[model samples]
Target chain A: MPPGTALDIRDLTVRYGDTTAVDGLDLQLRTGETVALLGPNGAGKSTVVNAVLGLVPSTGTVRVLGRTPAAAVRAGCVGAMLQHGGLPGESRVREVVELVRRSCPRSWPLDDLVVTAGIDGLLGRPVDALSGGQRQRVLLALALAGEPPLLLLDEPTSAMDVEGRRAFWTTMRRLADRGTTVVFATHHLEEADAVADRVVVVAGGQVVADGTAAQVKAGIAGRTVTFTADEDWRFAGLPGVTAADRQGERISLTTDNVEATLLALLAGGRRLPDLQVRGASLEEAVLSLTSRSRTPIGADR
Target chain B: MSTLFAFQLRRVGRNRQFLFFTVLLPALFTIFFTQVFGAQAGAAAQYQAYATASMVSMMAYGALGAALGATIRISFDRASGWLRQLRVTPVATSSVVAVDVLVGMLLTLPSLVVVALVGRLVNGVELPLSTWAGLVAVLWLGSGAFVALGLLVGHSLEDKAAGGAIGILGVVLAALGGLWVPVQLFPESLRALAHTLPSYWYAELGREVVAGDGPALLTVLAVAGFAAAFAVLTAVVLRRRPLHAVAG
Candidate 1:
């Protein structure tokens, strides 16, 4: 275990009765890096998170900041937002946060915690009275109360609307900028591609791909070409373009060959000012990688 | 564990709706049953005896209901996912269960104490200090059976079903144990059935302690056996179907 390492897991396996939920998974995360565990439902993402928290029994080594998972959790160096039972009802939001704060000896200042989670206004509200988004903000505040060096979140924004998710990720980006090691599990490819510095695609209890978003998408669906065109102008006739998506004046053409697609757009004397080309969308890359894993999920279960 | 205990106290203790059911209802029952039943006892000493016995019976009833009835909250906690959430924290699962059991037993006190005050002030049933303490202790300790039943119900059944089961159990235990209505008033066959119930022995122990009999051997064994049986049954239910919703 090095000082820069946030988490190190080797040969991790979790079983419930005869069913194996996580099978020999290995993952390592570095300090000050925000990583996403991207996968579809039942890909062992929740089981992996539970194993790291020491809430689920597993056979392997999971070192959190150079300590066992339970020790690190008790030391208040690791924080998590799990899918099940993250908050208790009947208490005000402040009480729940205060309860966690009391257990954390190296906690951050109360003011910083409330501000970072964007829950300063929600402190006076009862936990039950809060909307889903407000509750998430409070849960995030509780997760950060320990000033943990590492944070783990499981499907954090699943209950939130688009605007609530935007607010949540804004707070997350700031935490990443401030050098907190964040490991979040999300099934949304767009979220992983946009928010995370690196994405680990998991499926069938194994890592199918682990790299930067672009690297994961490198060999998948060619590239996406974007240019300013009228919504009515269809790019379907363009060479090598598999799909053309029109968004008002912005047209995105998904093509297997960027050069052939670009040549066709320019052949008709099109003056495209917002021209840009990038690796294929994360959605394609995940579909290909997750399906290519050794076992499809249903067979084992 | 202490912090969780304090939180649990606030949750069950401060809720007005539950307080009415477990505490106030039993106290009212004590006054009503004493007045209604004591009207026919011609002798003053006999009427006083009836009042004292009625008060003790209600006290046992209240404590039993409080201990057993509060387990519905555990079902709700399981449904709400609070149980699972707490498991991942520094607090151990056994500590949480201990806290719930401790809180449930603590709640049993209000009913016993309230019924005692009603007996002394309203019904003029006086007893020595030691005798009063002994009766309360007998009933309170006997509540262990109800606590075990509550835990079993809370961990084994679903949320909506657990509440109904606890309610039906309270009524049946009271009826069979001769708490709500005296077994003396029942037919010969019904009276024989009462003798077989743990509730019957549970209430008998309290009566014997109040009579300064030091809990007759048979009564003590019966109550202890029933408590042990319920505890063992609870363990078996939990092992077979772990509160998986709450158990990580």
Candidate 2:
């Protein structure tokens, strides 16, 4: 309950019937920080966001700007763009934004909000007539109409085209620069890496890793070296190599020291064709961590 | 709240089907019923009585249709996630419900006017200005019960089913409540059964006003009671099954 904390969730658990969606999750976000909740499908990322927004029932405490989620929402302290559902299709874009603006006691200037959401050209169109990306921009405008300090977006750019997505991020970056705290849930690792100052990876209803984008990627030990060679069990026992797999003529090795592993491969005097070396991507880091946590030691042998 | 109300009013106005149901259908029914029934009554007084009754019935039907139309729109909005979006804003749930009912009542006005006009011009029905004012007032107030009924149906059923159900219910209620035929013409037992319905009291309010007698206190109480009961039922259902899209 600090002044600078934009969101505070402690031991939050959400259950639907017998199934637990989010299990004892805890998270905190500071003012002006842009964080990404990164996870695969059904990893409880949406549940956590819903719990914070009070859209879903939860057992533990969730506070936005030192108040309950509902209170914060009513006070115009929080705004969100859910992954699904949107404005009523019959109304024009400007009308919908005006409706949302009327709900709050204080709101951003109408023209400013329209410009920030990039919806100036879309104001006259009906909601159902617009394409998916255009509708999303209208929803964003509605969310930002109140000029809330904390914004929560659930897969906000999922429907946008490449250019649209890029433009959306540019707007988001501007908002963040103006000291708005943003927490968005997305499975797009590249998006998280590009936009988030911090990333929280959830898997199996738990936070598997939480750190800066580069730090999380660095958690996975080394680079991968793939080459076409005769299938050899000796590669698995080579120095600095953690694991090795072969698919027909192609061999892939996970090595802690890429330089030493390369030297050893060349010293063997075997023909190595189609060699490819790459560092671990954010996706790989998350996959490796989640899979490792699910598998017990000695079971992988 | 005023802005939201205006937005809802605009939405209802733009819907073609709603306008047809609220104005055209009721006006046509008024003309047809007045022509068919107005001749059967032999005396001039009898003709006045028949035309007045027909006018009230058609107006009630129109108001009921408008109320149901509003309910269906609300259900569609809930299913489409618009309600969820509103819930996150500073607007309260009660504000939305109030606006919906207000819009429904406002939409019913055209239907009432159309039916009254047909009764006056085509059927030669006549009443003092005060009587007309009283009838319009009671009829408008009586619409609250049907609005609540619409809400109950909307919250309980899916969009398609709710529309069909309301349509059927409207017809059944209109027949049983003595809107189609005067309750006095029915057998003693049938008349007794009709009197128990809120629609009977609503029609009675219209009949009493047209007869130059003020609305009966018991009828007013009965209509108000029905309105209160329907409102309670809608509130309970909405609380138990908060509006959301049904997952497939």
Candidate 3:
């Protein structure tokens, strides 16, 4: 019904011994969409990535590019950059790049891969000698060497600096625009908001919220009402207010029904002083969404 | 597979530690043992006899480094998550192990050849060209057991512990296998214990070749058995707990 489904994961569950990591999660992505699996630590982000790569045993139906993860991998359609792994030591960057490239059923030219990853200058250097940020770029190049249609990166920018992160995401955007479906896992709210076409917020191994960044930020509280409330102002008991934070002369209230809360505040001859109302920022929305995990607050899928 | 082998060979070639143990140290041992333990030139026939056997032992010792070298690389790769990363590629997991095994065997050749050269030139151990060639061939072929053992050790232990474990194992194997000390000098009970070790069979194969005899059928079978057994154990262990570098 849509442009080929890049990824379709249904009821995916992963367990290690007595502990369950991912529980009944469903996710679908379209070709060329830049998606982020946004979550805090231990939110099953890596497990989901591992499942998509067929690296861990799990109960799930995960199809990448219309094939099983392993089959897609064999077909050279899925390339992944794991969060933590040391590249083979005693190897030059060029050798590592060529090694992964050769293993792919479909590969780009070495020059093209290096240029795309911006690691051409580091090719002949030993991998062990590269700095952390430099190594991440080299690994990114290695992942792209196969010309895979689906690019999965787990915390790709973790080792990068601010400038490196900005540069890395730019390359990702360029690649996505050219038809590669990019899926990355990160906890950085701003990254999800700025870089992802769709943000899937996960907490406690379940999809807590999933939508465009704007929609996810508006899913739970919808908006925040902030004003400088002096003492003796009891805002916590206001109508439709789910959360209230007070700091000195500033008070911020997150409300599902901003209109109702505003009306009630101005009722009884009380003035809504220094009033401010705005949609929640991605950070506020995510914090509220994750903390209310017991409720399973639904967002547009 | 060839690409993997070639890539791995380059990596192994650059590992200074592997090169030292596989080639340099063994060459040094050949000269050290032959001169200190064996007869010099113009010595008695019994002296020359002892020297040739010691030279074969050193050659066997050198070949042993191949397995140790292979073990270190495999374990390090496992611990570092390199193997896990390769799993996501199109390459089959079994192919990586096969490549590692092949690399391990290839690495042994340098040690075997260098040790034999040192034995001939520096130690003045005399042997026909054919005999020297045969000794190298037999020992090279025999090193598969060590490589298999290395693979098992790699799978069984983490990288940090693997190095020490294999080093001790190599020394113990050399001592009991009569590579470091002649089994003839061991008491009757200790020599019986040496018979059970694959390294003993590996060295005996070389001694048999240098003694102007075909490698003993039992010795060949023992070496092959060790390779097969260690390979099976490695497979079983890997299937149970793969080289998963990081837990989720």
Candidate 4:
């Protein structure tokens, strides 16, 4: 483990009976970095977060700020918002926050936490009376009560509406800007794209792709080009074009090099009309990468 | 830990089910049993003895019910994922359990006082101040075993099942422990069976304290042994089934 690293997980494996939830996963995060763990359902994203929080028993080691996960928790250096956990329904919102604050050695002021969570109106309401989105905010307040240096959130916005999601990310951005190491696991591709500085894509309990958002997108096959042209069999033979299809006057081509394909199309004085270029979206990139047979594409470390 | 205990206490204070079992029912039983038996006993001294015994029995019932009701509360917390949420914090599991036990004991106090007051004011039963203190102390400490039993049951069963199980266990234990009727009124064979239960020892302790004599050494040892055994069983259950297993 390197000094100053916010989280270091090495060869972590979690199993349930004969099924493996997380298999030999290794990941590290530096201080002040916001990383997203992205995967489809049953892809072990929540498992990794649970392992980091020491909530599940797993083989191998996990360290937060150069200490074991349990040690960091004891020092009040880690906070987590689990995917499906709920607050005490009988307790009022503020009282629940106060109860959590008492467990930490250092905690944010209750007023500040209430404001950050945007739960001022919910302070006096019983937890059971709150809506799903409101309850999530209360849980968020409890997670922030410790004011920990490391925050691990597993699908924190799954229960939120559009407005709630936007407000939640705004709070997260502020926390990350204040030098808190934030690692969140989310299946929402757009959420990871919008909020994460770096993205780690996991499939079948392994890190399939790891890099900045643009880098992970770029690591996928390539772009696509479409143009209006006469039906011809020769377009498929163009350089950098992997596949080509012609239907009437429209031609679509998938290419590894968009520049080279365009150059080839125009080099022959081919009058291509209505030409368009489209880059692969993050969703497409994830699908293509995970669908492969354990292909470690662009897993550059 | 104090905050957790205080929060739990406040929740219990508002819980209608807890109030019904721990306070209202016990007070009603104390009043009803004393009225019926005290009027029929004829002799003033015998009437006083019956009223005291009824008060003690009702107090024991109330304390045991509160301790077992704690299992229902814990089961709800576990089902709702609150217990698993707490596990992620810096609070130790043992500290949480300690707070639970403390809250259970606190819930018993109101019922104890109410029953004792009923015995004194309504039934004209009187005891020395020291005896009152000693009886309360014994009942309070003896409740630790039931608290441990609550924890064990909470961890072992699901939410609704746990509540039903604790309720049934409370009634059965009360019947066999001679808290509902005097042990002397039972047949020899039933009395022998009652002597084998931990509840009997607790009831005997209360009787001895009310009779102006200290609890026997064997009774005290037996109660302590029950507490230790239940505590160990709780620990074993917790190990076999971790809190996160119930997480949503």
Report the error of model 4 at residue A10, Å: 0.6
Backbone clashes in model 2, listed as residue pairs: none
The residue pairs in collision within model 4 are: none
lDDT of 1 by residue, A1-301 (tens): 7679999999999888877878899888999999999887778888888889887778989999899987887788888787765466677787777777776768778888888888888887878898888877887887888888899998999889999899889888988998999999998878988899988877667777777877655534567888886646667777877667677788887777889888888986868878999986555444445545444223342
Model 4, stretches more than 4 Å misplaced? A220-301, B187-189, B245-248
CA lDDT of each candidate? 0.80, 0.82, 0.83, 0.83
Which CAPRI level is candidate 2? acceptable
Write one digit per residue (lDDT tens) for candidate 1, span B167-241: 998888889879988899999998999898877888888889778777988888888888888788877875566
Worst 10 residues of 3 chain B by lDDT: B239-248
Model 4: per-residue lDDT, tens digit, A114-144? 8998999888998789998998898888888
True contacts kept of 3: 0.61
Q: What DockQ would candidate 2 receive versus the native complex?
A: 0.39
Listed per model in order, the count of residue pairs whose N, CA or C atoms clash below 3 Å is: 0, 0, 0, 0
Q: What digit string (tens of lDDT, one per residue) describes model 2 on residues B136-239?
A: 88888888888888888877787668778888888877788877777878899988889888778877777777878788898889889999998999899878
Worst 10 residues of 4 chain A by lDDT: A292-301
- What docking class should model 3 receive? medium
Fnat per candidate: 0.31, 0.53, 0.61, 0.60
Model 3, residue A153: what's the lDDT?
96
Model 1 stretches with alpha carbons more than 4 Å out: A16-19, A219-287, A290-301, B187-197, B232-248
